[model samples]
Target: MPVLTAECDPRNIASIALLKKLRFEQTGYAEKNFDYGGIEMCDTAYFELKRKT
Candidate 1:
C-alpha cells in the first residue's frame, strides 16, 4: 500500500494549491494548532493522498 500526506501552515495558499493538484484530499484542520514560540500560535491543515487501486 502507498500513501502520502500534506501538513502545513493553512495560510500558505501556494502549498495548499499544489497539494490539491497532487490529488491530496483535505481531511482536517486546527486553530491555534501549536505553540510555535511559546508566544505565537499557528494554524494547520491536513490532507491525505487518495489511495490507488
Candidate 2:
C-alpha cells in the first residue's frame, strides 16, 4: 500500500480544516528554526492518508 502526505502551518485553521474534510489524518508535528527576518521557530503539522485497496 502507498500513502499520501502533506504539511501545513498549524496556525492556519482553514487549511487544517480542509485537510480533515479530505479524510487526512494528523500524524504528528514538528518545530524548526526558520530564517525569516532574522530567526524564528515555527511549528508544522503533518498529515497523511493511506491509499485504499
Query: Which of the numbered candidates is closest to the native, going by highest lDDT?
Result: 1
Compared with the true structure, what per-residue lDDT tens digits does model 1 show for residues 1-53? Answer: 67787798999999999999898989999999778889889999999996888
Q: Which 10-residue span in candidate 1 carries the lowest summed lDDT?
A: 1-10
Instruction: Provide the clash count, candidate 2.
Output: 0
Off by over 4 Å in 2: 33-39
TM-score of 1: 0.82
Model 2 lDDT, residue 19, Cα: 95
Backbone clashes in model 1, listed as residue pairs? none
Instruction: Kindly report the root-mean-square deviation of model 2 from the true structure over all alpha carbons.
Output: 1.9
Task: Estimate, for each residue in 1-45, the C-alpha lDDT of model 2 and write its tens digit.
Answer: 899999888999999999999999999988874334656777888
